[model samples]
Target: MTLPWETLTGEPRTVELYLTTPAGLALSRSMFNSAVWKPAIRATGIPDDRHNGMHVLRHTYASVLLDAGESIKALSAYLGHADPGFTLRTYTHLLPASEDRTRRAIDKALSEDQAGDDVPPSLDGLDTA
Candidate 1:
């Protein structure tokens, strides 16, 4: 699966990240050095802080997606999680408070069915002793 960052780049190059250098096509951990990361961050007008970095952006994306009511299963697939359980455990707060609503709906349907079963028929002055 393609990474979200690759999609956001909006450019097709033979190399994935930096592209065409002695250091190969793909990005590496060393590519995130203070010189490379800090300047790019500064250019973006985001503050230079210890906690505010690329990883923080990833976490923000995950949290936002969860809060937006996306399904845990979908999120797990998106995040490449081995199991959906991790997604559920991480974002349990996003679950809907609909237990009461579900129960009420079921009860209402059952009540309607019971009422229909008791329907009475009208007779036009026809009686037999």
Candidate 2:
């Protein structure tokens, strides 16, 4: 469940926490107040007043997934959502672009398909005049 640091960053660092330092006793709080989080918050233009750890990252991840055409059901599963409806409601705004893209793709596919070209018009015998 742990990611290999070497894969993302070549910097050598240990993941283990020893209780010797104040940070080691409460890792979440320490990390939330750390320099890394502070800089990341500034860089991302996110308010630093949020103290709920890196939950903004979770929101961003969900938004990104939804933006990438991932279905709400799939995103719910990936995020361990308690209910698919919750995921849908929470990420509704993030889905419109993806939905539009999908709609366009389907329309494009249908337009390019030659299979329907041979079908005679159903109203051919009906004259509007």
- Candidate 2, which ten residues in sequence have the lowest lDDT sum? 120-129
lDDT of 1 by residue, 1-129 (tens): 234344566555452454333555454545664546778888989898868776666567777887676778998888878789987897676665668868998786556556764744335221211
| 10 residues in a row with least lDDT, candidate 1 | 120-129
On the 0 to 100 scale, the lDDT of residue 30 in model 2 is 61
> What clash pairs does model 1 have?
none
RMSD of each: 12.0, 10.6
Task: Point out where model 2 deviates above 4 Å.
Answer: 1-47, 51-53, 98-103, 115-129
Report how far off residue 78 is in candidate 1 (Å): 1.1
Candidate 1 has an lDDT of 0.66
Compose the digit string of candidate 2's lDDT tens values, residues 1-129.
Answer: 234464575555656554323644535656555756677777887677775346667888998887777888999999988799999988897775556767997786556454475745544322322
Top candidate on lDDT is 2
